[model samples]
Target: MRSMTLGLLALTLASACGRNTPRPAARADAPPCHCSHDASAPMAANQPLPDTSVFQMGVPWTDQSGRAFDLASLAGSPTVVLMFYGTCQSTCPLLVRDVKRVEAALSPAARARTRFLLVTFDPSTDTPERLSALAAEDHLDLSRWTLLRGADHDIRTFATVLGVQFSRVGPGEYTHSNLITLLDPQGVVATQLEGLQQPVEEFARRIEGYTR
Candidate 1:
């Protein structure tokens, strides 16, 4: 059972879309993407990543503090990532709480080296100011948590890299999968958790292993 769970979650990290994935409207200006995934073998910490690393993308981003950010800069630490918009009323809030639980489970040493990254799907609405407000409202520690927005095309590319499916269904409305990915120090996925209201103890233990 444990192996099966890990295998499925690993496939998600390798960018395997679910069978019922929604067909989002295509963007004419979106860049060509050649996402790759190899879940045939387990990844080790601190190794150099392949061309398929999520950190390989060079898309520019602006953080909640209105500072320029790079995906590659998160390379040297364990990162917990969630793709979400600030104004989401339903699942996004629950997802945020889930991640907060994961944070609370970590020891001070582990938490200090770990970072939480939130990327918004609705970049236009989730501007730097709004993201900052959301973080403050959530009472997230700025030093360890980051909220960022990028161009739509870049956001799509990044989401594809992580196998996070999302589509704008209505005005200020988006339907997306609830995914939490753990990236190793070298920016390769170490594990992933999907869905909501699930126990995060296993996820927390896996992260603690990487810190040791």
Candidate 2:
């Protein structure tokens, strides 16, 4: 009777052990809790970066110096392009200031590798010389900064390709996105920085990475 009782007890223990297996504890390698990005988040990274989207530079547009410039000439390398109007009192200045901040944040190595390109939607007014002055006023180093202009048609075309939108409000005043687009060495847009709130660190990282 004792031997029979012991056998039954061992059988019950073996059955319980078979039913339960030890599980590994939760760890950092575990998948993050599933979550979605904000539905209303800006469409900043919506598309794959391209080498060169679309640019029209060869056509005649008066620069600030009143000399005609061809947009095609500025192609080939990575560019940080932004859209602007000369007479804007709001975002344009701030946009330039933000660019200046990015410039100041770059290491010497990055300074030599990247270029800042500004194209004016208000081609009628932002002559090359005026644009040059604007760059100087904002403390932009011309060694790597190139301001270009195109006829209204070319400007519209460039903006369309860049997905940049600007609306003219008053004589010389326009409301536009404070955007900075990163183009790869081939002229394809890698990313666009929308809004001035993004940190200069982010700018440096994006520029450094894209240009690299």
- Tens-place lDDT per residue, model 2, 1-212, is 64354535665666566447432322233222111232112223334323344433245655555566554444444467778876777778788777767777877776676777778878678877788788778777777877778767877777777767777776777766677876654455556777775777865775565444
Q: What is the C-alpha lDDT of each candidate?
A: 0.80, 0.64
Which candidate comes out best when scored by lDDT?
A: 1
In model 2, which runs have C-alpha deviations exceeding 4 angstroms? 1-52, 55-76, 210-212
- The per-residue C-alpha lDDT of model 2 at residue 51 equals 33
lDDT (tens digit, per residue) of candidate 1 on 13-48:
555566565424323423222212432223444556
Clashing residue pairs found in predicted model 1: none
Q: Estimate each model's TM-score.
A: 0.77, 0.66
Q: Who wins the TM-score comparison?
A: 1
Model 2 TM-score relative to the real fold: 0.66
